[model samples]
Target: MSHEARQARLRPTLISFDVFGTLISVRDSSYGAFERILAETGAHRVDVEAFWEHWEHRNIVHYCKPYRTYREICELSLEETFVHFGLTGDGRLINHYFDAFPRFFLYDDVVRTLDRLSRRYRLAVVSNIDDDLLALTPLQREFDLVCTAQRAKGYKPDGALFRYLIEHAGCAKEEILHVGQSQFTDLVGGKPLGLTIAWINRRQLALDDSVPRPDFIFADIQSLNDLVEL
Candidate 1:
């Protein structure tokens, strides 16, 4: 279907969001954390970009296992990345990364976009994060409901978290729109479950045709206002 047709069909009562890369800016924060740790260990020459990609892949892999605290998952993933590069994984460095969550800012458009959308649609967050870690972010109070992997005991690409949102929202799957930046988790996970998926391609990345396509695509949260009229 074309974007206009999808837009016409979308009359969501609840807008579910993936917090990390959607509302909050994870890329910069992750890079900063990795850079600091690398400098501390005299591994500054290592490719931080590649390190982040590996760490993220490992984190997603860990999410598939029995649920662990997001902190534990982060520590484990960081350790895996360190071992991959033959660097000693320092406990303090792991703690630094864990503590850095509160410092990560939202994208400039997030608050305004959310505020506007909230006037029309109830907002909820479904994240592959622990409750405590999610509480540290500025987005903790922005949603009508917040579901985490820690609470669901499962992560995205599994549909457990999205199911939780559906149940809690007291709405049909068609009445909710799940929006996020991760194609593998959010799009692939939510689309199969009959929820309308919105790919928030903030970075303008090309869509991977192998995965399920989102019903709607927006460059950022702000673009949502154009598709969803109050």
Candidate 2:
């Protein structure tokens, strides 16, 4: 049975979002920047598609470390990834990834939806990214509250990040609806914090049974716009 049906019922007063893949498409921008850096060497070649796969896994791995801002991790990732591929070790070329940080792809109806939703519900962002990286997104203007791992000193799934937001937002946990894509980050992290989560399952990937459960599910952020009107 679906959570919406099983629960007593919920009418969220505030909506929190996950920025990266949900509100913005950083995958292409991140990959393209890496591609340019790779191209500068001119002596190295790599499968661009494979680059994203390996890069994403490495990124997820970086989160397991003690704690570092996403930008720092990405900077290190750029250096290590290129070195591992036997590409040029030029930091300047790799630093371009950070230089072109603002080149992110915003999702459809984001501004429009936020514009509508903000009227009724508070809006916030609960992302796994660091302080600087999360601020780079165009959606910053649209958020009422912004919580980053740097401020929390821990990434998502650690629950510390969500707890930071709960305290910062000054809203009851029940009233806060955390809308995100990853159950690992959103559900597992926020669940313990007592923040209701709306799982934005955009990839059509099947949910792993072991993941912490979510309060609600949406196909994507596009579908969440209605929450404001409702």
lDDT of each: 0.83, 0.72
Superposed Cα deviation of residue 168, candidate 1 (Å): 1.6
What's model 1's TM-score? 0.92
Clashing pairs in 1: none
Q: Model 1 over residues 119-216: C-alpha lDDT tens digits?
A: 88898999998887888877746578888988888888777777777778878888888889999889877888888888999988999988898888
TM-score of each: 0.92, 0.82
- Candidate 1 Cα misplacement greater than 4 A, ranges: 1-9
- State the lDDT of candidate 2 residue by residue for 1-230, as single tens digits: 46555454446766888787777766666777767766786744687657655655666677767888777776677666666667666655646666666877687767777777778778888777767666665665846788888888877877778888888887677778888877667777778777777788877878889887886777877676544344
TM-score, model 2 to reference:
0.82
For every candidate in turn, the CA RMSD to the true structure comes to 2.8, 3.7
